[model samples]
Target: MTTLLAASQTAALLPYPALAREIAALLADALVRVPARLVQALPGGASLFVMPAFDARLAIAKLITFTPANAGSGRPAIQGDVLVFDVASGARRLQLDGPTVTARRTAAVSLLAAQRLAPGNAGPLLVVGAGAQGRAHLEAFAQGLGIREVRIASRSAASASALAAHARTLGLQASVADDPERQLADCPLAVTCTPAAGVVLRGRLRDDAFVAAVGAFTPAMVELAPQLCRDVAARGTIVVDTPDAQHEAGDLLQAGLDVARLPDLRAVVLGPARPSPGPVLFKSCGWAGWDLAAARCAVDQLEQS
Candidate 1:
């Protein structure tokens, strides 16, 4: 019989950064991307996705669901399940909770993107949300970058402040952004962790700025301003895990960014190591392989424990 695990169980077993680094390495090895297949529902909203990938080593399949309304109920906004199987015999290996995997993978990808795109030892990082995912991003990036400064920006300054205070306990110099966009002038790197339907990085920022946006997967939602996309197009390369998905993502869509024109992840060297040409932008459209890869890491941890 296949063993079933819960999100809480997975949480207790896995360390966020370890899972993130493992996933990042897997992705760097030419693992396929899983573009989320979305389905819009009634009064509020939800989405369903089937993520599948295979190589000579292993095969993974997962089903993920997203319900924004669940947040008020103190439940995760996104949740899912994993069905790991043997590639040679198609025998089921194990079943694990999906939510923990999603959050970790999302954060891990954000960290990997930051490492590849943001300037080294770049101080004064601005995180644009204070929810679970936002906190995860802050933690993973701090571990990966040894971040010197971090500022949390949210619709509620109070919540942002609270989150910043929490980070301080983790040995990070964090605080809330009194004026998020204003911080952009001084902060070299900015990360948008919200699901806002409109732009959050407003006003002017220096030309040599790196922005990593992991919000608003749909074509109707956006966190980065359209002007920033235009700026990156002019001065730096806009890196996307999948350009086709970005075409559907709201930030680029609302900006009227030509999806056909933007460069894909394959086009850029996430590096063996190099300095960015200018201010690079990395956009994520919520892929399934990321979740699967992170899940694999969590499962390994559980087995060891």
Candidate 2:
């Protein structure tokens, strides 16, 4: 039987520090082994992305579905599954939930960037958007990074309030504050995970604020303003998930950033990132390698339990 792990089951196991560290290591390895992420366009203007990574015996692949039409049809904007396999036999070992894997791994990647860029101590966190990505980021930054307060920003007041309520359940001080600039007043870290067609945050942030955005995957959408992008590029450095960020990250593309000018996770993970006098911008276009790593971790946990 092919074991199927639902989103809740896989997600419940993600809070473990050991698992998180393991996935982070895998992600680092994946970045080196797989330099580019692959995407396949499906009919109906949808996309299928394949991200895979492995060592000698085991391999995992994340197959993601992006259907823009599912924006509010009860279906998710992103959907798919993670497949764990035995390399020698080419046999499927287990099936893990896609959204859960993507959510956890994406947040883990954000934390990795923040760990390298943000200050060592905890600071107020600002999470833009109130969707799944937003909620996941709230938990990750608060529980994983020890941030005590989180400001939820969204276009919908009810959504922000709901996220704030969820945050409180996690024992973090949280509140809804729509203004990104206002949220950044006392915060040193912000993560934006929306699908806005235009800019979500602009203007100058604190001197060393850590900004990580996972939204704006298409050329038509953007979350980070050109000013912020240019400022980060000029002042500090812009680190991305893959070398091909310019293709998917509309934020970088619209900012007039040259793909060669951006620093990728490969170099950043190997050692200390480049010097930066200003805030560090870590923009991720959702690499499949991350999902593969996260699935491996989830499978290990499931087998042990």
Candidate 3:
């Protein structure tokens, strides 16, 4: 019988640590096949995304909608579902919540990259957005990396405070930052999760700092200042989560950086030597392979249960 998992149920199955492990394994093996996803334009400045991926054991497709206008409308900008199928029998095995998978997998990818590229995994993360992605990154880093403190920064004070409170509930020392740029210098690890048309974070960062820039997936959106990208590239290393980032990573593209020359997360994962010296910047653009890994994780957990 086919099973459908709700958002909460899906979350329970794909824990950060396990999901990170699966992502690492996927990267190392490089067996999963993910073709370019199709994006269809909708009437009201919205888009529909059809992403598909497959491996020997399982095949999955994620259908989701992206509506930028939903911001502040008490509705999510992205929503959808992931359909998982058995490869050998061509039978539907499970259905996973799309947004939940996107959130967890994206954060898991960051955690994996941080483990491989970050100067250090120790505490005090600075998160630039207080929405779902911010919350997911907070929990992923705190639980996966043993981070004990966090600083929240967002355009909305209420949202920032709420995320801080949520962090406190997780037994972490949390506070809202009035100026995220000022906090950047002190934060050793950070993740930017905002959806901004312009730069939302920029400043001098500590030499050992590591940042996962997950916001602004399209070329037209940007979160980090152009100078920041140039600075990181000059001082340290800038790694992309996937090669698709070359086309979709607005932060790097807007910075006038040649993303094609940057090393991808897979290289960092498979390399025997650590990333080059200095701070590291990891740019993530959503990929179907990530969702495939999430599906594998969920199915494995379900079988064990």
Candidate 4:
């Protein structure tokens, strides 16, 4: 029988530290394969995404729907499941909750990027967007990077307050920022998790600031202002999660930056260390390889438990 894991159960299996390790390992391993995902448009600004990936031990496919309009409707904006299979036997192994996997793995990717690219890991993190992605980034950075303070910002005051309160419960100093852009200079570490309906983050960052821009994953959606992206490209380093980001990273594209010239996470991970003088921008456009890493991590955790 194929074991099915609920959202909570799946999350419990993929802890940030372990998940980050798995993602880092996969980034360094060339054997993992991910094909282009299939995306279909649905009515009322919704989309269905079919992503598949495989490695020596496991194969997985994630089917999920994204509805940007569901932001505050008490309904999840993303929903679906990930089907995991054993590579050798070609038998079904496990079914994982898709949104949970997406959230955790995405944050883990950011965490791994920060570990390698961020000038400093210890932080007073400025997280813009107090939704699920924001919460996941908060937990991942707090646990994985030892961040002791956080500032929450969102279009919704109530949502920002809720995420701030959640942060306080984690034993961190938490505050809601009325202007996240102004907070950028003081907070050396930040993550933008907004929906990218329009630009939500802009303004100057500290010279050594590290930002994981994860909100905008399409050509039309963008969170970072064009000027901010250009500044990073000119003065600092801009790294993408995958080569697919060349087409999907609206933030960089809008800035008129040649994304093809930028280094990807894998190249950074398997690097011959280079020096960077200014802020680091890590742009993440979701990739199936991340979900495959998540599946491997989950299966490993299940066996140990």
Q: What is the C-alpha lDDT of each candidate?
A: 0.71, 0.78, 0.92, 0.93
Candidate 2: list runs displaced more than 4 Å: 27-38, 42-44
Mind giving the per-residue lDDT tens digits that candidate 4 earns over 75-118?
99999999999999999999999999999999999999999999
Clashes of 2: 0
RMSD of each: 2.8, 2.3, 0.8, 0.9
RMSD, candidate 2, Å: 2.3
| Number of backbone collisions per candidate | 1, 0, 0, 0
lDDT of 1 at 86: 59
Candidate 1 or 2, higher TM-score?
2
Candidate 3 stretches greater than 4 Å from native = none
Q: Which of the predicted structures, 1 or 4, would earn the higher lDDT when compared with the native?
A: 4
Report the lDDT tens digits of candidate 2 across residue range 1-305.
56787888878767635445765677556333443557799989888888777666567777788887886566888898888887788888888888887877888888877776675438788898888899888887876788898898988788889999999999889988868777776888899988665688987877778888998777678998888889878777788887667787888888888966677776777765454677788888876666666756766777788
* Model 3 TM-score, all chains together: 0.98
Q: Write the per-residue lDDT of candidate 1 for residues 163-281, one digit (tens) a residue.
A: 89989998988888767878977787777888665688865555666777888777778887888777777776677766556556677777777766666554554445444577777
Question: Which lDDT value does model 1 have at 85?
Answer: 68
Off by over 4 Å in 4: none
User: TM-score per candidate, in order?
Assistant: 0.86, 0.91, 0.98, 0.98
